[model samples]
Target: MTDPNQSVLSKLPNNVIDEILIRLPFRDAVCTSILSKEWRKHWCRLPQLTLDSDFWKSKKDLTGDKRATSNFTMTIHNIITRHSGPLTKFTLCIQYWEIYPPIDNLLYFLSRNRIQHLVLKLPRQFKLPPSFFTCLHLRHLFLQNCLLLPPPDFKGFDRLIRLELHEVTISSKLLESLISNCLLLEQLVLRISDTLSDIIEINAPMLKSCDFTGDMTTICLKCVPRLTELSLRYYRKDWKEFDVANFLTSNFFESCPDHLEHLHLDYGVIAKGQEIPKKLPFDLLCVKHLCMCIYLDRDEILCPLSLIRSFPFLQYLEIQMEHNFKKNMPALECLEMEAFPDVIFEHLREVTLIEANASIREMQLIKLLLAMSPALVKMVISPHRFLGKSTIVKTLTKLAEFECAPKAEIFLKLV
Candidate 1:
């Protein structure tokens, strides 16, 4: 019997075979060299290489080799040296804890080859080589647990589009300088960096998406004229409190770009005595999609409602609910009376309630939104856990009885 797989693969063009090999892990793709002489020739031409730490660890476990770091370093050096084509993408993740692998040589080779996409996640903070910053052809760069110290005369990444830094130690001034230099940069993400304690300021005019998740006293969006999506997850540390309302009210958001559309705010963890902002500082009239992940406590609930009133153009709303069922729902009538008269979500078409148990308070809020949003089209209620069929039916019946929009549809989803 003839093997159809081999027959089909044999008929494939060399370029198609190279494409397939490029998508596979470096180790697996290299192993295909044993399949045939043609495959061996095609594999060497692959432009993408992903060297994951887990693969090296598994190899070490199988071979019982204590010098895994040395082996990994040598393997990567040999692979880079033997490659026949221009390297476009390279990812290296080192997991050996005993010693820091020599990455300067690898980065130098990649830089010389004009790599376009680069990702490095080292076990410890490895100082980046100056050659890395000079990779003019690089477009996407993601570094985790690395030290970045750009030279004083650092001419920025001219063609870089997306830059992500996680647990990287870079000063606010240096980061701003680096971003200011990237003329064509589009998206920027900073996540949980221990060194970022100062007031962070972003001034990218061409940027479209910005996301920050960490502890910062203040964040100022200096001038992101083209920003359409913004996500912020503030983590409170010690007794120092950060106020979201103040940030929104600042000149930064007050005169925020009109192009902004998507906004996501998550209050990850608040201190015992800390207080969540009661009201948004400025109206999000231009925003169309809004997501709020907050505790369903007295102060937190009012903020979302206030935000709903502020963003009159909001088309989609997603709320992640968190609260104690043992405690009674707070008096929301006062808030409703104060905010509901000004709130008419005429453009809101979809509402999503996540981690909901269909409790009385949640039902009330849903009903309130349904009544307010005259153009509501769909309401998706995703419960925290599965419920009995009878319970689901009852819940649906209750929802159907609510005075919703003329064409509103309700769906009960169990998770």
Candidate 2:
């Protein structure tokens, strides 16, 4: 008879056991070594390791001593040194300690082991070493709060598919060279950076999605034929400093390829007396989804209407209303319904209004869209959170009474 003490995991094949160990978290995987002789040292050979600082913080809390910090640093050094096989993925978020030697060694080891995906959230003012850029096998890279200066002999990571930089300091020319060299890059995200003051021109041919949020003098999209989705949210406080009118009308959209489908624009916290152009530079005849967040005065309610006319094939629309006291003051202006263009939304189907207030101008805008979109199927209205039930009821009644497409369905969602 077989010994009943034999564990079920021990009976499994070595390859199958390795697969199970790899799925466990780094801490738990290492702890599994105490279970039996067969499981010992198995975690050391795993291909992926995530060295997050939060893990060490919890250990420090348990030990109730400051020495845990040094031990944490040593623990990471030992893991990198003892590991035998290639490390395909590594995520290091250094939040507690400022030690650089061990971290540099870790990066060197990962570079030699052919790491594929690396995420580094380093401390403030920390500069990434040149060896970090030499990881040719990297497919996804995310760096936050660090300085990025490529080496003189830098050839880009050709295999990189997705790259994200948040609060990183790098020159415009260096950034352009980096993107130009990534032949396989498909997605890129750039958050606010203090050092970025010059124009940003993206010429990635294979790029599919791009998200940019910052204050730049100008943004140029060139040679990006495959780009479909683009989101731009400019820094709010410095909106007046930027040339909003020139940026909107300066062939920015005309340079983009025609296949663009989704667009999101948020002009945050516009002050009073700022003029927003009623006309957009490029016609978005192919766009199917559009989202706009603006702070427009009563007179400028026609701005969104003008945008609607540009997209004849828009199927879904989402609008976010920003409250501006100066803009919200009651005012009356005769809306010339006939003067507006008689464009038909042939493929338009759905519209969603968030934080919608039942203003007269808003109602008129809704009525115009409803009259134009014969193919509309549904409209969802979500009131602001602070609105009372009675106000919501009134808003819903107003929408229901409004004349729309014969078959269009209306939905009122209260928050």
The RMSD of every model to the true structure, in order and in angstroms, is 3.3, 3.7
Model 2 agreement with the true structure over 1-415: per-residue lDDT tens digits: 6445547766778778778877776777788888777778778888778766545557553343456556656777779767887789888776434543246667778889989999987766668887787688899999887788877888888899999987777888778878888889899998864646567789898999988887634467977899999888777343555555556666777876788899887645444455666667657776889998744354555555666677778999888877643444553342445756666788889988888776656666677678778899998888777767887788778887778887899888866
Q: Candidate 1 on 242-273: residue-level lDDT in tens? A: 55555544565564689999988875554444
Candidate 2 lDDT for residue 152: 83
TM-score of each: 0.88, 0.85
- Residue 318, candidate 2: alpha-carbon lDDT: 87
Ten residues in a row with the worst lDDT in model 2?
A: 325-334
Runs of candidate 1 exceeding 4 Å displacement = 1-11, 57-66, 95-98, 193-195, 236-240, 269-281, 297-299, 324-339, 386-394
